[model samples]
Target chain A: MLNQLLRKLIRSASGRTQWLLAVVGLSIALLLIFAAVQVQVNYNDLLHGKTNQDSVANFLVINKLLNNQTYGNATLSAAEIDDLKKQSFTEDVGILTPSRFKASVQSYSDRFPFYTDISFESVPAQFIDVNSKDWKWDEQSAFIPMIAPNMFLDFYNFQFSFSQNLPQLTQDVVKMIVFKVNINTPNGVVSMNGRVVGFSDRITSLLVPQEFMDWANQRYSINQDTKPSRVVMRTKDPGNPQLVEYLKGHNLVTDADKTRFSKYRQIVNTVVNISWITGAVMLLFALLIFTLFIQLTVSSCKDEIELLVTLGASPKQLQRFLMKQFFPANVFIVLITLLIVTGLQYWVYSILSQQNMFVSAFTSYYTLLTALLILLVLWITNRTTIRKYVVQQQK
Target chain B: MQIRLQNVVPVPLREKILQRKSEVWNTNIVFDQGHWIKIKAPSGTGKTTFIHTLYKIRNDYSGDVWWGNQNSREVTGDALAQIRQQKLSIIFQDLRLFGELTARENIELNRVLQEPFYEGAMIDEMAEQLGVTHILRQRAGLCSYGEQQRIAIIRSLMQPFDWLLMDEPFSHLDQENTRKAAALIADECSKRKAGFILMDLDEDDHFNYFKRVEL
Candidate 1:
């Protein structure tokens, strides 16, 4: 019986054009908000170096700015390390342990022979982006696992190997080849077998495990000062502008890739923030339109509502009656908005993918969250409006 | 149940009722169960306002009205709803009917809100006695004033009540229709042993009253 009365009330009170306008406005606002949140999630994933397999570690190599003079005061001091550690963006800090002993590598193949004098450094295993069981060393081991920077291989393949007319090596092939390493210790020259375990894009140096560097430095070098000139920092947000500005202000230099990635991150953050603000403004206007629509509906139904109240209808009951008419409309609006957003997202993904960029085609979790948020707002507004109007009529 | 009215004066008609400064506005009255009472006053004498105040629908009045021990002014909204649903019912002077609904639907709306106070066939019988059975299918708004008044009377009687309040219920009805509507009301009140307070401009022979109050 109440349902019948409510239906009659809605039929008489609702203006079709006004209701359509309100729904369309709300849907557009919701669509924009959902799209913004989805884009933000995808971009955030991309900027964090997330891939299908593994994410690029948020790590940066910090060093003092170099000068023209040799032996310039470009080494990171202990005080400087403490200052970097004090930053909110810095999650963990580790120093790159420099090689104290002299080292040389030689490799011979059937078609080619290679020889080079190389510099070696090691950082804590946590700061190394490569994951390998061989990234550890012991004093009794005859072979040392090493990780070389990817850029070194790129340079070799592009410049040195091509000019020399030698065959280029893939990562798997490089990992299989062994090099004879010679270390000049205080006692004499010692030879050991070395193998490449993995490649790192974060740090540019040839890296051995910290354990091996510590032991080799103690057994070989005569110098007592073992202060490191470079530090590796793990930060929560590699793209933080404040960290970048702080580094620049202090005349500190980090890896080019780190600064480049930070710049990309800043752009992504700016886009996301702008999208969020725009979406929020649209949603606010949509809510205002919705409020006006509800006010008009209440005004049109005032007489019927007053009669119902005088006929022993409680405020809550009247609110429920009006809510029945609105709740379904809200659900329909959300569903339609989500459907439209999903289609638009696919179209956007297709456009972006054609440009050789890999962004997630859809962020289901964020989409669900957005839908839920819109529904909650609609429900609250509908209930509050009806309740307020019903209470007024009761008075 | 008994209703006690003490020193009640309608706010809008205070000066009219208290024109003589020496006159007293205070009065104590009680209507017990199964008692038929009439509140008689000409037009513009706050007759409807007095009935509304007694029904707990209007509170713009001084003093107090007590339903047994509960003050009418202090009744919570839910309590008032319950009172209207089961303890009290009213037929407004305007016959507040949903114009868009048929006469049967108007009465059914109130009938389904409460428990099964009257059987479906009983409503049909009452409609037949009140000469509204033929127009029961017609929209109440499209029906004549006299037909709508009969429908409103039937709708008000659909719910169980300890006290039924009527405001000029027979104003638009002819003598014959008024006698028939009064018979239906009296029969229902007698079945439940309920009291009724009827307000009108003049007394009539349609009901035997236990008391009369002038506002």
Candidate 2:
């Protein structure tokens, strides 16, 4: 009997204008929230360097800012290094060991007869991307393994080789080429065979083993104190705003590409923030519309509800009657929103896949969980509204 | 069930009752079980308000109303629900019927609230006796005022009530229809050995009462 009465009451109380306002507002809010979640997930992937094979780790290369007055003092001081080490984001910091000896290289291949003066810089083995065995050097070894930047080869192939009408060499071909490297140490002028082991996109300098660089620099350097001009830092979050602010405030220079990536990250963060605020506003409007609908329904049937209460009906009974009226509409709205969001997710996944971005189509389960949470909140709100109305009538 | 009102004075009627020192307004009264009573008042003297207070629907009165030993003010939610289901029933002056529902549906709401007090056929018989069986299929709002009054009377009688509180229930009914409705209520009250308080502006020969209070 109560169900019958509830059905009749619901039919009389339901208004199309209120329902349309609520549904449209809630749908917009849900869509915006879903879009925000998707954007944040993709942004996180990009920030973590998940999609690129040549992406750098959570590392940054910091160097002294060069100017006319600070050029001679550009070397990192021990005090400056200690300050960097004390940063919360800094996981590990290592100095770039500069070569203090004279080094020159001559290629043996007739296809590439080239000689150039080069400088070597060495860092910890963990920082380099090459194999440990290939990057090792000993005093008895006759050949020195070298790692050069991949950008150098790209430049030589695209600009230098194209202008000179020479055949472009692949990475495999370049690795097989041998060079005679001559180094002038304090003891004597030494000649060693050099072979390219690998190419790196992260570090820019020509890299040698730390052992070789240390031994050569100690033997050849005249100055006892040779400060480093560059530093490598492993950070917990390379995109930390505090780290960026700190670097800017100290007038330090990092890799140009890393700075560009940081800018892109900041833009993504701003977009996500704006989307969150917009979604929250939409949700607030939806809530207002929902509350308006409840108030309208309750006010329209105020006399009838009071009559029911006078006829031995409790507040809880009236709440159940109203819940039966509104609960289905709330569930339907949630279902429609979920369906639309799922379709949007699939479409976005296809678009991303077509562009060769390897992001997964499915977002985390929390999106639906959040929708369910919203539904629960709406249900609770509806119940509270009904209870308040019923209690008001009793007074 | 016995209802006790101790120095009861409704908030809105304070100036007229407490200040004027009306005899019945600030008096202690008790309506015990198995006794019919009448509260006669002039127009705008809080007749409906007094009935509402007895039904536990209004609480603005500055006094205590005890339902047996339990104060109405301190009745817990479950106890109130139980009282509404089995101990007390009311027929409002407005005959609060869902206009969208049929006449039978309004009565059936109370019938299904607890264990079946009257069989379905018995409800039809009562409707037949009250001359509303023809309009039972019609919506309560579409029915005439007299028809809606009969429906509300039948609905109140369908529930189990130790005390039936009526607020001018027969105001819209004519003599014949009012007699028919009052007979049905008295019959139900006699079967349950219950009593009722009928509030009105003037006295009528509806039932023999133990006492009458003038407000």
Candidate 3:
């Protein structure tokens, strides 16, 4: 009953228009802040998520752009490889060690006589996309295992077979045949038996095991060039414009089709930054108006407060009463803004998923945490302001 | 509660009170528990100032006013509010009521300010006894001075107190109303074994005052 009467006395001092303005301003400020956080989370999910298109884009083969100034000397030094590993975009680098000797491969059967001069490259096992049980090589092994690129089979089946009037063979037919590999030594050509074990989709080269490449190169190498000309690295975002720009500035190149999201990423970054700035400014203004409104209400009820204190109303009572009136409105505004952001996030998820791009269907935890943090700030502001003005009125 | 006044005198009337003969000014006096006391003073004798000093509402006076073992000037903030809520109740000369509230609401506010000294029906019963039942729902600001004073009297009685301080509590009422109002005040005070300090201009055969002094 006393609270009801106190409410009557204090309500006449403040109007409804100022309260409505405060609620509206606070809602807009919170909405913008939460939207900025959600945008960042969505973009991060797209870059590192295990979706179909993004996984292939995460592993890029980078090499020097073969131009007139540097055609033959396009090899990457140890320092250059280390520098690539140190960049924020690149997670790991695997050098493609090219052969320094001449080699050739010939079919075992006279029915399909195929002979070709081919260069071999070896990379660390993690970068290879194909998995097979026979992908290991040692001195005691019976036959050398080789991984051929999928593009090599495609070219032979479509162009080479049509021109040479030869029949196209399937992968199982080719895998069953053992071929003769010849390495040119100082005395004569050394022969070894080898077979195709798997087909890789990433690097376009005949890949040998790292251990075999080490032993073969030491025994039969004729040249002194040890540096690799190409490298394959796993990256978090291939479409990051900074990564592309850094590569271009250093005269390096990657697949142009993979960096297609550079312009779109730049546009998204601008929108996030703009929203952050606007939210911060609006939050400041909203806090300012709320503080001024509270001060005005207290001052308008100055006479009534004095009489109340003189009549035995404690300062704590008035402070609690005033806090009860204002803090709930702030909580309500925050909840309403959260509801709006949730609806917008669901709509955005549907639209993005329609285009074969993947993002989370629900809002991220970081955005909810940001909203809670803002509510805490508002609570502190309300508490201190009420305590300050009520204490002043008591004196 | 024992109210001790040691050399208490209003600063603005310092010279005049010292020149004339007085009993409360610059005099050591104590009003013990459960004593009904009255002070009679003529014009410009600081009757309201004396009452204000006793209530600790103004400190623009010399010397000390103590309630029990603590000095009134030393009390402040919520402690002072504690004393006011639990020990002291007042009826001012101007009949200070929340004019925007109704007559019954003005009385009910004090009734529930602390723990209730009486139940919810006490307000209506008191208003009926004081002949303010017809104006119980009327705004206190729109009521006449007699009705407002009766509301203030009932408001003061709503709280438990060791001392009930009155400064011309019945100045605007008629002779019959004053008689009836004094009877209610005396009856309420005797029921709780509490005391009162009434300061006025003239003398009257009101309640049997336990102690009378000339201010």
Residue-level lDDT of model 1, residues A117-200, one tens digit each, is 876899987888788888889988868999999988898888889888878988888898998889987778898989999998
Q: Which pairs of residues have clashing backbones in candidate 3? A: none
- Which CAPRI category fits model 2? acceptable
Winner by lDDT: 3
Clash pairs detected, candidate 2 = none
| Cα displacement (Å) at residue B24, model 3 | 3.8
Docking class of 1: medium
Predicted candidate 2 versus true structure: per-residue lDDT over A28-55, tens digit per residue: 8877787777777766654554563234
Model 2's interface RMSD: 2.0
Error of 2 at A96 (Å): 1.2
Runs in model 1 lying further than 4 Å from the true structure: A9-15, A44-59, A67-71, A88-91, A99-117, A125-203, A207-227, A235-249, A258-261, A343-363, B15-25, B42-45, B98-102, B119-124, B137-142, B212-215
Off by over 4 Å in 3: A12-17, A51-53, A68-72, A165-170, A240-242, A356-358, B6-22, B25-28
Q: What lDDT score belongs to each candidate, Candidate 1 first?
A: 0.81, 0.81, 0.88
**Every model's DockQ:** 0.52, 0.42, 0.76
| Residue range with the least summed lDDT across 10 consecutive positions in model 3 chain A | A11-20
The candidates score, on chain A by TM-score, as follows 0.75, 0.84, 0.90
For candidate 3, write residues A91-203 as lDDT tens digits: 99999888888999998888888899988999999998778899999988888899998899999999998988878978987788899999989989999999999887777
Q: Give candidate 2's error at residue B94 in angstroms.
A: 5.8
Instruction: At residue B157, give the lDDT of candidate 1.
Output: 92
lDDT of 1 by residue, B93-207 (tens): 9999999888998888788666768777777988999988999888988999999999999999998999999999999999888888899899899988999999899978789
TM-scores of the models, in the order given: 0.81, 0.81, 0.91
